[model samples]
Target: MHDFCFAIPYGLILMTGGVLGYAKKGSTASLAGGLGTGFLLLLAGFLSLKAFKKGRNSYLAMILETGKPVFGYRGMVYAQSS
Candidate 1:
């Protein structure tokens, strides 16, 4: 289940590139476009995953340090007065 979360995007990008590559008349431009799109998608996915992990770690640390949840589903946090 967790693995699929990562695998799905790669699979979709590969399939999309394949389709685009095939649609073009075997020209260099088509191949280039497909490869470029695939590369950019991969790069974006990698960066997003890294950011998500970092954010989750930061949120967890904040919760531990503050001894309270940082935000609710509604994106509101209660402030405590010292």
Candidate 2:
């Protein structure tokens, strides 16, 4: 799936454009846009990292507690009853 494939590229472009605009034209809008976007990216990264750690910890806990593998598809949890 090409999901989220363009995120980084577009983010970089926005940042570069912002810097260029701020440097060449001295536009406050450009500076604000870059700062805002940078903040958003940072937030997204933080949230994603948190989510990944949470999921990994949960999976490991489940495996250790149940001694059975857990499975899921498309965010749907499937617990196998032993």
What tens digits encode model 1's per-residue C-alpha lDDT throughout 1-82?
A: 3322553386467647656776766656556545554544455455545556666333332232233223221233233322
Cα error, candidate 1, residue 51 (Å)? 0.8
Candidate 2 deviant stretches above 4 angstroms:
38-82
lDDT at residue 4 of model 2 (Cα atoms): 23
Task: State the TM-score for model 2.
Answer: 0.45
lDDT of 1 at 23: 75
Question: Where is model 2 poorest over a 10-residue stretch in terms of lDDT?
Answer: 66-75
* Candidate 2 pairs with clashing backbones: none
Report how far off residue 55 is in candidate 2 (Å).
8.5
For candidate 1, the per-residue lDDT at 7 reads: 34
Model 2 CA lDDT for position 7: 34
TM-score list, all predictions: 0.42, 0.45
* Model 1's TM-score against the true structure: 0.42
- Cα RMSD for predicted model 1: 15.5
Distance (Å) between predicted and true CA of 81, model 1?
Answer: 64
lDDT of 2 by residue, 1-82 (tens): 2212333354466678778889999999787767556444444444444545566323332232232112213223423332
